[model samples]
Target: MPSSTSRRTVIKTGAVFLALGVTSCTGVPAPSPSSPSTSTPSAGDGPSAAFTFGTASQPLGLDPALSSDVESYRITRQILEGLVGVDQTTGKPTPLLATEWTESDEGRSYTFKLRSGVIFHDGTPFNADAVCANFNRWFAFPAALRQQAPGSSFKGVFKAHSDEASLSIFKSCTAVSADTVRIDLTQRFTAFLQALTLPAFAMASPAALAAGTADVLNQVRGGQPLSAFATNPVGTGPFSLGTWDDASVTLVSNKDYWGERGQIATINFLTYDHPQTRLQALLDGKIDGFDAVTVGNFDQLVKRGMQIVQRDPFSVMYVGINQEVPVLQDVKVRQAIEMAIDKDTLIRKFFIDNTAQASQFVPPKISGFNNEAPSLGHDPAKAKTYLEESGYNGEELKFYYPLNATRPYLPTPEKVYAEISRQLTAVGLNIKPVPVDWSDGYLQKVQSPGDHALHLLGWNGAYADADNFVGPLFGEKNGEFGYQDPQVFSKINRARSMPQGQERDEQYHTINVQIAASVPAVPIAFPISALALSDRVANYPASPVLNEVFTKVQLKP
Candidate 1:
């Protein structure tokens, strides 16, 4: 998985923000402080006790470097500390593990000064050496790490240099001094500092790593022995891993945490298989907080005195067309798929105002978004004409969607697939829905070109840059769904090479326009992030990157 930091950087470059000219009552409201009173008792009014939270899905994996799933990252954020952290007031990058850092004249090298007296969860010393080891391990397993979706950029950031005298490559990085360490990159990158804040780059203790007898600190691969320390992670963050059940997890206070201590001594993370079950848990007080609230139950939750935190997520949900498939290879056929489905109706009826009808591939929250680009409007007559002109004669089209991974903000993959099937049938195309498990289905069927003709997937802007929106989805090496567009590849390369300014923005605009014309993927909707919190948890900040820092979270008691 690409780090949240990288995602933000990509959005800034590729998916520039649009004005969102459409006026609707169902948009993101201004941020407000948590309500002080509700039917739920305040922490101070009751006993000072532990609080438990719940989610609709389980974490994909625990090892930070190997797993890129959102739920896993959320848990790791509590157990890990990065070199830099988001500012409490502004939510921008600030110094964390590294007190300060300075760049060289060419921006290729960085020297960091580690904070003093910081310790990992197991009481191991945290210093420059620990930082070096963590990064070295990640660089070693680049191929394995890159297998996770959106993690390909890790290779672009770090490079290893060999000593000619010994003629041997160095796997472990050396600390320059007690508090200082130097990192040499292959090329000058503008977002190097921001990338250091990613969970994949977080430092781990050498002691635990050695005791586990693992080559790397946190490795998650098939057939490899599980790291003993993963079940009880030790880091310099506010909370330490306590107990982990299949359906839930618990974290205890790290008494020696370098930052502000959490007001609550214990925090629990519970999981439910379905959205309805999660909402029921929240209403019955079985869980204190939950996210991605179902649209069907949004009204009931509000009536029950639950506080909903609504924000536009950086992700854009869409349908990916297999370019290798003969039927979809025709530009007119791709355009037919784009025009047949009704985005506005899907958003209004299925999502019920929780989603924005996406006009382009990128969402509006990203910076430098091109608002003037033309959107493919819903026109069934035109779609039918195009299908006839393109020589498509009711060919059977295979559409694959993950069965188990349905979120409330967006229409269920099955529902969207069914709608597409119905719409395309009107245009004289036979569509088949192939539903598979969320775990292996995405990688095996949708990502592989040999499996299906069409697949449903989503892209959450890794960085705020346009490069993020353009590069991964269109780059030649992007194996995800086997999409390889040479023109798109050239445009992304040009945009990346250009300096940060108007010139780069223009290059990205051209990329977006070209992508819209090619129609590799049909934009569906931009979903909103909906979260509910109990009155006891205070100062819970909202972030599009999903980097929830527990240091500032306070219990009312």
Candidate 2:
């Protein structure tokens, strides 16, 4: 909405698909359902050295704090500046808006030294007060507004908002001075800084927030409601929003940007709902580069002399189980469902060659990946037996899968669902297909409260921590899973506060193992995703955590 191509299936470099904690950025209206995939470029006020990119889908929303889709982040990464950024080499959080920071109060507080001489796109000074304002804004979100954002970055990361103040980790944000900002947490969150690196924590212009009514969703674009500020986001990044239309989103280079400006004058993200359209666009020189290269397009692209860049495995495609379904409430039934799925067959047929079967959500590169995570291996006979023993009835389970969408984790939803449905049917379980268009609220419908017994979805790691994977998916009573286990919840909450060491790793390992046994969802594979590029680009900023920013991109002579 994304695939792997090469025999090795990955570039030596690694990158994660982070739109996580669902990092959606606020932006202009979304494209209409019937809108064309291409847009008109504004020549007069647009960038001189323009770069057009092909994308799989239109961004759901622009507010990183509210949405969690990849397309939204693709644009936001250029226009927004997070408090921190991820280092390409070490996979650790580095200074961005905050030049340096000190951890005190047993990891419960952080004092940041703001970078001087920085300003947002709206000419608002980027200072300590700005940082505190953003933090305070997140900490004090109203419950109704919190429910409005599908991604809910603060609710997912901090676990609470103003309504449940006592339960929240965010205690206060204080402007220690014009250049210093102090954030006090009610509890230790060892990954606080790492979490801050998310685009959702990016600082926006205070004046723009007020002028544009950032919190108000007064406009509807592409079926999703947003605000005026969302339409024209003002942040201190390498690019600023120039124009947004049905066919494309145009971003002009920020003339006042403080960092490396690179050579790009404009970036136009052209939406191509299908993989072939993207390939054709690049072939026709309609774009400089494109992402989400699929398996079907690999040989054709390679034969046509396209440069394919593969990102290392970081996302886990899974079949989400909603316990609210009467039949799914039985643990035996859930175990049977997992056992019926042949990971080997599924990956070999639908995924890139080397995609590894996953036992848990956390990737192997992360500290908490458990080699011994319990898995119900493929066995149709065994699965049938378990289902029969659990009082088998002809109950049709509604399985939801998105249409016209491609993602790093889920490259082809329909094909994947067909295979999975075939496997599940082999074990005598009644199956029902509920297909939803990607642009038509597919993600929200599945993730929100619903009667969907099962669904096709996955998480692309936002940060380098296990919490980024498990914490958001199983942190609490998520509408998607409806998995309520107090013990598991306590363990996950405790693990988030542990220092990054053996003890913390062990705790995460335990949590992964526990979740596997509980079977809230089935972790299928560590998918290898790739991007296709035009020869015009000498080098692209491919990051392991998807921290690619246009400022680092280099152009060919």
- Evaluated with TM-score, which candidate comes out highest? 2
Residue-wise lDDT of candidate 2 within 57-141, one digit each (tens)? 9888777767678888888888989877776666656667776777888878788777778899988899988887788888887
What is the lDDT of every predicted structure here?
0.62, 0.82
Give a tens-digit lDDT track for model 1, residues 135-237.
7666655343244333323433332223221311123355988777878654454445545556766677777766764333354432222355555556777
Sequence-dependent TM-score of model 1: 0.81
Model 2, position 357, has a per-residue lDDT of 95
Q: Name the regions of candidate 1 deviating beyond 4 angstroms.
A: 1-49, 142-174, 207-233, 352-354, 391-393, 406-411, 439-445, 448-450
RMSD of each: 8.7, 7.3
